[model samples]
Target: MESSSSSYLNLFVQETAFYNRIVLGTLLPDIAWNPLPHFFQTWLRNYIGGTLLYFLSASLWCLYIYQIKRSVYVPKDSIPSNKAMLTQIHFAVKGMPWYTLLPTVTEYVIENGFTKCYSTINDVGWIPYFVYSAIYLVLVEFGIYWMHRLLHDIKPLYKHLHAFHHMYNKQNTLSPFAGLAFHPVDGVLGATPHAMALFVVPMHFRTHIALFFVEAIWTTNIHDCIHGKIWPVMGAGYHSVHHTTYRHNYGHYTVWMDWMFGTLRHPIDDDESKKEF
Candidate 1:
């Protein structure tokens, strides 16, 4: 931690860099692959470091959401049963070799002991930061929205790639494991935006790191049937519909896509939820 207080951006960057270094200097790994510089110099170092970042970041959110499930944010049984959660984790572990592509294929850099990250604010200006952030939010959501919808629209693809996740059918039966327990292809598709963004735009490395955490949390939350006033944004409630009905609400981050495509829908209710997984 910094001895002196710093801005949020500085703090996030510091935290991200610290975690990257932890994995880099240690033995943890996904696969050896690298095309960056400095601390991200070696293939093994980058593999271990990036995968470590994904695991730790995802685990932290799982812990936070676990608390919420037991407390105010949700009912005690909001997520899958402990045994079921463990099973999902096990299967997810089995798929690690494939899912490892997400981090291993992505890139990172560092300079002067600091992780190499471009901040729109530092590189350009505040206005450009706003513009880029807005653009990113729209495009990423749009991409995921179509991608999800297409998976459902295509039958063979769903059976082979997307069907496993649907097994955890209940809205409350989703945990962080459920968030990532995707078939390797599914996981890569979901993660494509991350790799694409690094080259497509000028973004702070901190923001790049933040996006992973956001994806993890949102993925878990959207599966738990937690609805909100922001109907445009696909939260827990929206995605819950997709799982149960096996149709509708195919958008990723927002209902706006669903709305625009005439797929927006209200989440299933207690009566509908009881209709068996």
Candidate 2:
């Protein structure tokens, strides 16, 4: 009787462990192979840090736009009426709803089968998270830069897809999401390459969170008037020129590539000023 009781207890423990593993593997596959530390890291960076930064930056920009519209001077002859412009800006920003549906869909696709192509590198461990992120960032930036330049090169696509963003030529906080109000094709083409990077590289949850925050911050800065005033050293005026002329400043994040390839367009600070390519 004693021997039988011990055997039953051992079987029960094994079954419980197996059940736990199955549950984790299904629900939280990112950390299934290496839980505990990886899970904590993901939670800390993604849920806590990333969420806080998104809200905080967005709130600050909203407030800044509100204040600027109330206080700034606008020439009646050259600029749209302040109230009219503000209404348009509000519409543009409100169009891009902040939701997790897209990311959730992407994550599900990755976990189920799409990630298998790159899953072989899963055993490469965690440190490559940062390396892969850095490489992906560069590749995405290059892709965006060239794609934007091409949009300008092709007039019909620019008129139909990119013109909505330039509707408000003057910079404002709302301009970042202005592009989001574009045709679905615009969104798909512009966003797919960045999203597809996950399948090309081994990424941890924390890397995804970091990329999200980096994109949000850079997009906001590129569209906002703040960069025009703050980052003057890094050719901050480039994006402003893009808005004003609709011809240049195609690079998304880093200016290094733009500078290297002679795509950098800086405005002339003088009357006889020629733009440095």
User: Model-by-model lDDT, in order?
Assistant: 0.62, 0.51
Q: Provide the lowest-lDDT 10-residue window in model 2.
A: 38-47
Q: Find the 10 residues in a row with the least total lDDT in model 1.
A: 107-116
Could you tell me the TM-score of candidate 2? 0.59
lDDT of 1 at 185: 88
Tens digits of lDDT, candidate 2, 1-277: 9776455344433432343355445555555444554323333323333344545664476455454553552222433345644554454344333222234344445434454213323545556745776777777777777777777779998888777666667644234333234444554456555667666765554355346556655655555433443332333356767778776667776555666666656654523223333
* Clash tally, candidates in order: 4, 0
Q: Find the candidate with the highest lDDT and give its number.
A: 1
lDDT of 1 at 188: 72
Residue pair clashes in candidate 2:
none
TM-score of each: 0.69, 0.59
lDDT of 1 by residue, 1-277 (tens): 4433235345444554566556654554434322334334333443454345545655675677666445755676565677767766765666655555454445333222233345446776778776766776677777787778777779998999888878788846766567667777887787676656555555565566567556765665565555764745677777777887877888887777776777766674544423421
As a TM-score, model 1 comes out at 0.69
